[model samples]
Target: MGQICPSTASPLCVGHRHLRHSLLSHGRSKAPTEFPDLSFLPPEMAISILSHLSATELCLAGCVNEYWQELADSELLWKGLCYSDWGNIDSFLPDGMVPIQSYKRLYLLMDDGSSLFNGDSVSGLEFLLNNGVVGPSDRHIGCFLHESRRLHADKVLRLLQDRRGVLDELVGLLDFHDVFLPDALRKFFTEVPAPKVRGDFLEHLLTKFSRRYFECNRDMGLPQDTTYVLCYSLIMLSVDLGSPHVKNKMTKREFIRNLRGAVQGTPGDYLVNLYDNIYLHGHVAKKSHYKVYNNADF
Candidate 1:
């Protein structure tokens, strides 16, 4: 009879090791199941899908891989995001002025500006003024004005005007509309002492008014000083609207005529838009959209 092998050196142990090796080899032979490759999709389709992502999400998606990074950095995606959040770029900025060359850079700048201004940090004002030195293009100024609309527009303008060369630096880069319109709107409402406006409506009106103001300033070729006076005229118009002593509703034609006289330039389209926004849209109410509008509406 043959002797039995010890348990440690048994043929059964050898068989078990062979089985384990076979299983391991089998597992290794099969390919890994990966997630669907976004890169496999058409570029347009991928962008369309990415468009659903918020600015923050889009930025995060870029971190996944190089393929995603390429698509995530797309100009179209960033540009759409910009328009969605801030509306027409030309409306917020001067005509034909591309503040940052890339939409991605502009979006980042705007986002950073919004966060910095809205955040609790005290450095926002200093950063924005950049110590009265020449800053970036008017695009940056537009971003500053648009983002900081939550702050007192008059106060911001006053601060800028008080700082030597800051306002001039802004004016030199692009037309002063980026700063002027928002500041003027606030100044107007303050002087009128109209009813306080809701925050939402004030933001809307500021954007709309700024867009119209920009168009007017562009068409008339008005100098910076003239634009400044024109902003003052807008304040006077607000006074006329709010004053019960005036009694008569000023006609659109009359409003434009008055603005022209005050600024000594044709601000017809702008004044008409302004008059319609206030008179037709019921911007001026007994409760007075005045106070909030002063801080917000451009």
Candidate 2:
């Protein structure tokens, strides 16, 4: 003030402005007075944050803490995703979501329950029915059937036979199922009536049914030809789905019994021989005169 120094006064004013800004920033860094303590945040809020993450991220976070691993593996989370993602669709199968561990836990109910996404009791059944090689999509129904061939062969063979009239539309699916057929490609091209009909339909149905027959009859010691006839006849009978077809309710046990008897095995309600597919074409029925159980059964 004695010197009346303009430079000094200006420097002081600038320093004051800088100090004000630094103080403001420090004040902002502090929590608002109304803010709750972060350390005391509710567990629900924490879970919600974690739930927003992707599957890979969730998996990674699981490794970060034991609590996270428990939450991540909770079936509720996966089932919620399944229901939210595809449960509303007409063709959604909860079992289709089995790749997710949580959904797998609910798979049995999803498949059999009435509150299904499709409003149908059979979970994936609608999806399998509507989509096929004919559907514009990639048609995964065939893949599903192929996976069930061992346990559900009778069911699948019957389903395809019912749809044989539309076999042309099921090309891709038939190809997939045919993979289970030993030497399937060769048999379809060289020895089967498949060339005349839709090759895919015959290929799929025959391969699957034939495999089942072989597994159930090999040890019965039936001549090779008798076994082939048995398998083929069973395929034809189940698929007919006609008024007179064996459409009456028959459990797997009952069907197996009748099938074994038809093949000249012990007259019981289950397969007696239990063979494999290695000898499919090696033998042939000498008479081919086995009674057609029911032409309407197809």
Candidate 3:
């Protein structure tokens, strides 16, 4: 055979070249595509981007990875959300009460629906009540009372004392058919306010709210006893609705039985009607004969 050309040298050389080519091709095909890393972004830019996300969206973003978690849990972000949902946090906090957790935790607590009912026990309630920039209104106060059903009387007293027009708001809570005045009162008096203040407040509540109910349902043939004890009846109904010892869902008999002792001499039919109306509508039924009383009458 003619002398082997150097280019065709040995079978091993050809095999080596083929193996090298295969390795290069495989490396090129298997290479991972590069992606832009959010971690490389400036923290301020990252926070600014995350600021647009809602509380729920931010929570989901936090689960993505470590870097995003840091940005998602930023106090600024949460504080902003808290401010948006509930104005200045400091305005609502009781004089001596301080938050026990991060703004993030506080926001989450407020975001939870159950927190509205658990205010008495949850420490987060300290920051949950928000009076807004201008301050708390009757509607806001009523809502606060409704949400803070279990809040301590002392704390509620402090909150109310600091605010103007609280008595009017407290009465307004009753005027609206939707508010559970009994539970609201129970929450405010869990520990009881000063004797004079308590007396005046209850008197106002009884005079205004009870009289309104009476005026609204004057044509219903309600017993005078029902009218006289309507405020007391509301208190008893609150106990029935809130007391852990009693069944949550009460029958007509159970409802009447619970209130009959307090509202003695009121007919069962009247009591049942009152209970159904108050429980279902937060006030007695208003008939066509209902008359609007002047504020002076209260």
Candidate 4:
């Protein structure tokens, strides 16, 4: 036999591996065999469905074939992915170019550990130093950060208000090393337990968040926040489940179960989205995906 082709050889091998994968994952083992032709679907409709997919899905979709790759990597699709992942990137961009240009590169670079994974967190400290957007967050921050090794607790103790309370709260989260999660870190960890939010709590949350400058917007409205929350399924979407980039292939639905439990251990009608943390209100609710007309509608 000729030299056996190793799957790990080169770029060409990578492409072949993807080709082999596409056949199995999507439909058949043989390319020319009779099978369902998904490519015949209108491109716009296809891309829209693809848009509802996570960042990793769109990348994997690109590997399926040339036409699919072109559609998957289109500027329009990647733009939505960029905004969904990082809100706004103006601060992260170089001068003299608009957002999508940075987004094009961002799609490739987001996986780089050095960009976000290695930051020293000046922004969180700045918020605390500002006495926080609503001032009451001072207590919250202090309680959350006092003994935090990540906070350089000695330095934060001098700069922050409510030093006593922060220290008291900080004791619960502290450890000897920088590796331990602070109270702030604990909130984002889906596996960690959190207090259950009560019934009709979304309204209370919206109202509470609206008062804070950090939570609401320049217009001081909750509509944008509310809509985004419903669309992205809140903190549930921020996680990486079954990430093509990772060794494990857990689904996004499984991922959101962790977030939902962390956010509120018990559930309510408004919070349930059986759709794998994608669009909670998109197709099933028969609701328009456009703007929120009434402020109270959410």
**CA displacement after TM-score superposition, residue 4 of candidate 1 (Å):** 72
Which regions of candidate 2 deviate over 4 angstroms?
1-110, 113-124, 127-140, 147-151, 165-182, 185-298
Each candidate's number of clashing pairs is: 7, 16, 0, 2
User: Mind giving the per-residue lDDT tens digits that candidate 3 earns over 270-294?
Assistant: 5666566556643221111111110
Q: How do the predictions measure up, each by TM-score? A: 0.38, 0.25, 0.34, 0.30
Candidate 4 residue 252 C-alpha distance from true site, Å:
42
Model 4: per-residue lDDT, tens digit, 1-298?
8655674566545444554555677555445454333365556656776888777788887898898888887788877775565434343333344425444455555433212222432444443334221124334443333312222322332332224344333333333122211111222121111212323433433223223322223342224344334333432332223224545543545544644654453243234433333332222111121111101111
**Better candidate by lDDT, 1 or 2:** 1
Runs in model 1 deviating more than 4 A are 1-40, 60-70, 73-110, 119-122, 125-161, 169-237, 243-298
User: lDDT, candidate 1, residue 103?
Assistant: 84
What overall lDDT goes with each candidate model?
Answer: 0.53, 0.39, 0.51, 0.39
Alpha-carbon RMSD to native, per candidate: 16.4, 20.1, 17.2, 20.1
Worst 10 residues of 3 by lDDT: 289-298
- Tell me how candidate 2 scores on lDDT: 0.39
Candidate 4 error regions (>4 Å): 1-36, 91-99, 113-298
Predicted structure with the largest TM-score when compared to the true one? 1
